[model samples]
Target: MTKLTGAEIASHNSKESCWVVVHGKCYDVTEFLPEHPGGQKIILKYAGKDATKEFEPIHPSDTLDKYLPAEKHLGPVDMGTVAAEDEGVADEAEVARLERVSRMPPLSQCYNLLDFEDIARQTMRKTAWAYYSSGADDEITMRENHAAFHRLWFRPRVLVDVERVALDTTMLGSRTSVPFYITATALGKLGHPEGEVVLTRAAAAEGVIQMIPTLASCSFDEIVDARRGDQVQWLQLYVNKDREVTRKIVAHAEARGCKALWITVDAPQLGRREKDMRSKYDEQAAQVQDSDDNVDRSQGAARAISSFIDPSLSWKDVPWFRSITRMPIVLKGVQCAEDALKAAEYGVDAILLSNHGGRQLDFAKPAIEVLSEVMAALRERSLDDKMEVYIDGGVRRGTDIIKALCLGARGVGIGRPFLYAMSTYGEDGVRRAIQLLKDELEMNMRLIGANTVADLNPSMLDLRSLGLHTSIPRDHLADQAYDRLVPPGLKAKL
Candidate 1:
């Protein structure tokens, strides 16, 4: 392959001859313009220039190979000949913000999950941070997800032999170093250059499962390919309105050896995430060009690509999902006991009692609060152990995992913390966070006098304070951050 000159590449800027550089490689994406999922304008915006910055957050690493032919790959560009493109007018506010972030305490100083979040907030581009942290209107449920665990007081037992503690567990039959798996969070590249691949590598190294998000900037295969051969993985799906696309996605994941399929059903429509809306995220979507086919675009970037998710997904669709693949099909967003029962009746392998991290609906009960009801409902039907139950959202510590297990949860899922860790220090941050959790689990287990995960049960917790009307102390730090991000007009309400 001949080395392409940046000067030569610069000449092909028009729609008729569009070319762009990604990671120093020049590619002729002219033919792919019309077929781009986000639309053609995004490509044209950086036509004949380096698009790596704009491209990394929303597309997979192998995106070019999947969308374009080998001949379109025009080889590496000569850096010396490349003209320095204007970065457009820089915003003074953004410049000052980046400077402030650059001076924050070193990544090594980040000592806990919350510290990672604090660093991430200081370091991440404001828009990306807002999207990752925002929940539905008022964010009551979001706060409750964390607060619920606080409400449960531990009734630790004494006189139990605690010579050595084991944090190893299993999720969907795969062994894991801890009782939690890295849950899915979308648009990871918004925080780090490597996106979900960073999570994949960290999870593999930590001996835990990483649930690949359907809306990930990196494609599903890129995440799967990043896995160590013996590492287990799961897939999180937002069913596309196009059933054929859904079928194909499911089939491909099964073929890739995914152990489970977590079908997200909470987002019939995206909730009104005010922080994201305040960011004018739609403006970013507008920059992408083609409108999403099945959803309303007025919402924001969060909804732009999500327009294709099938709102009509229902019990009837469960059978269809079962017919398509052999992997266990677990509903990812069940929020109440009744729905949890319905999920079991439908024969799903498991039900993840979640509220989409409080992103889908405002004030929806936290998954932990719903776990007791779900367990009781299952017991009534002699299905208590028939279907596995898991929870996610606001899981920041091992004690939180122990609480959920006491309520009969098979395991818990964690999403935002790992993301914040990766956003701050890449894979090392992720590994450190996992090790921190393991350390906490060991210490907590020893203090709680539980010999193993099996020893954790309902008697070990006092749930009287778990009432919805009960007052839980404010997470002052989280509240301060939330207050800072709330649009000025909405500040009065908070």
Candidate 2:
């Protein structure tokens, strides 16, 4: 008994027997929950039961599909009762009907209707498809990303008048129509030739924030131009050990009106994506340029990413970056409270809570699960409101966004969902995806009796609603490097 992990003990009792079959695999989550300080309830929520309804609210939030295994573990938790509380959700049959109506084949449907894997299979070449779909090692983390969202069950409060709701919110002191933003991701061109240009422009048109990867398909100027109207542009950078390139990238973004600089630290080294290795994605990527004449220029993506990446950055380069630009500095790949505390001291304006689309590490905790731990740390250090925290990675639906906001996120980000929209249609497809999320968010807002984004608080949540546990550590945590970020004198106060 002492040897059993909370998740493992929970999994042993599941219908799948000896395995919590999520997205089709037997993961030993049993030993994992005790490591998860969030407590055992989270893992128990999905243990020995299917988590389909619990998963619906958090579908698109980047937790990875940890719930598919719950399909085998789903244990008669009465999900219909929970979903019935949401005002905006059409009849279950209606969602099915809408999804069915959305499958009118390619050109007829806008981009947002397709499922995550469907868009990848349809838009990207075989190799790109594999790269986008593949996860590290055995893909447990990839599959778990989705399943983790399933564990975060929604506890709706009915009978409150939520007729007119407010989705308006602010991030980094800037007002936003929705708490959602276009998260930074690598190699946009791989999905469609229209690439970053088509995608960011589509985001800008939607009155949202447009963020670009440092290794963008097009130059900073080109992407900014794509967002010409009122779109907000943010840039993502990887601080390679090389200092010079990092300075240049930061400077280049500020010169182009790029509002924020997001430094991604998760991929200090890349994750082992087995799918891309076997798919020979490089060879398949070459085929796009070979067939460039047939590509869609309106979408604005080049045929290859080889043309853009300038990988040379380091942690030492962060301070030097602040010296060169006034744009808000945001660290994008922070997973723990230690890093969040360090980010505050470093004079970081924000911390992007993420697991890199489950792209960098496998078997790591899901982004949604990590949100509270990071926020708790931020509050402990009194930087909760001083610095913003934006999360991304397994979010697929509007309720997922609402749940994150209630959990203390300044806002949320979506990568795969937008990419899916682009592949399914184009600008129009991407637009539909954003609007659907907005409608869902607002609808849920009204039904839940919440009037504004400010109405979201930890109080709206209940601990008994779930059973969470994981393989996270209770000790041996690292010291936060806050001293490293601030001016020398400020260190004394911390």
Candidate 3:
């Protein structure tokens, strides 16, 4: 039987509209109705219609012929003219999730996207929150992480009969819902009892790739299974002192269907987190043998470091990691263009720009600030064209995403915010948080008259008011980008 693609279903359900059916899934895109960064005319064409053809270029990873047929066969979307009460709707994706995740109240309530902090506070101890929430020597990077968005106030052009916006984009030759990577985090159980398992569920549902941490409580096989065989999972490796053990872990992740491997190079050693340092929290160090249900922090900070980390590491070990995996290799902590280019030289598949949530390095420029420089270099070698480039730091709004995208990131990732949401609500909370981010991204996209993330160019920005001087050169600007932007603690509210 012939079935309708998500776009066809959406078109059938709504009157006439514009929207992106990213990776064969549909989104409402109504709330982000007005703020498209692209001109209204282009967006309106997509209103109530599927923009799949528009998406193909950005998402080159999938073969169009196969996806086209599958999406159609998924089901028929009830075309227009049904009563309001009709069972009229369509379907979709995202994060890792254990089928074990609770769909009920305390669990369900935690699913809200807006309760970012509440969830973190709920699931984590005050000390854990301090450790997770606080950043660097003074948290400047933390503040800039969200504040960088203000530098680019979107310029929305009007009167073109706007209707829809497309959110699909390519990342390392793959399809994804948004141009945002589901950046990895430590100890999924810390956010919700479901831990990495629940995160995989969220990733499956949301259509974003999951970057599973090396320290995940659940085994790699467990995480892969929860993805339900419909996910693109990756590994986030922390090069440890034990090269053999580290290689083993990387090999395990690859063996378990992981498509990419992200080696975090920024912390040859962990950063000094004053917030965690000042807290009453003691670290668990490691799990009690044979017990799957409890964390023993009795050994305090000493053990926490032991269990949470593998200290002996350096860039020299990149070749060792390369020898073990056929999957894409990404470096997770490139703060500058130099590092990004270096990763390219080392034959990495991608480069993820981050400051480790200000967790590893203090006073570093927020990742967003240096995007222009990194992107310029990426573009220089055609590496940006072949390999993926990502940024993660102080990203809280769609506008921040736009700035980075304009500067040339294949995509961006959010760590603390989603982790905060997960801590509070579990899978549903993560869903909500991701949705909110998508909404914010769509809103800003519409406002600026831009359709794709790649359309976000510096020309759309008026950095002049933000104390930006064109003469200083992009390199210098990237270096000082965070200093000039307002912090999330200040006036800018996404």
Model 1, residue 487: C-alpha shift (Å): 24
Please report, in order, the local distance difference test score of every candidate based on alpha carbons: 0.83, 0.62, 0.62
Could you tell me the C-alpha RMSD of candidate 1 in Å? 5.7
Where model 1 places Cα greater than 4 Å from the true spot, the runs are: 1-41, 64-82, 88-90, 106-108, 281-298, 470-494
Expressed as tens digits, the lDDT of each residue in 51-148 for candidate 2 is 33332221222233322344433332323222222336566644653454344354433322334335445434555566556677777756566666
Residue 264, candidate 2: Cα error in Å is 0.7
Clashing pairs in 1: 39-290
Q: Encode model 3's per-residue lDDT on 109-178: one tens digit a residue.
A: 4322334664354335555576567665677667766656565555555553336788998777678888
Error of 2 at 317 (Å): 4.0
RMSD to native, candidate 2:
23.2
Model 3: CA > 4 A from native:
1-114, 122-124, 157-162, 280-303, 306-312, 380-383, 464-494
lDDT of 2 at 174: 69
- Evaluated against the true structure, the overall lDDT of model 2 is 0.62
lDDT of 1 by residue, 1-494 (tens): 67788879889998899999998899999988776655667677788888877778767777788668999998998877777766687687678667756566655565568777877776788778888999988998898889888888999999989998887777788887788999999999888888999999999998989899998988898899999978989999999888988899899999999999999989887788888767745345554433443334345558655756778888889999999999998999998888988888899999999988888888898888899888988888899878999999999888899899888888899999998898878999999888888888888999999878888899999988887566656799998677454211101111
Instruction: Please provide TM-scores, in order, for all candidate models, with all chains considered together.
Output: 0.86, 0.66, 0.65
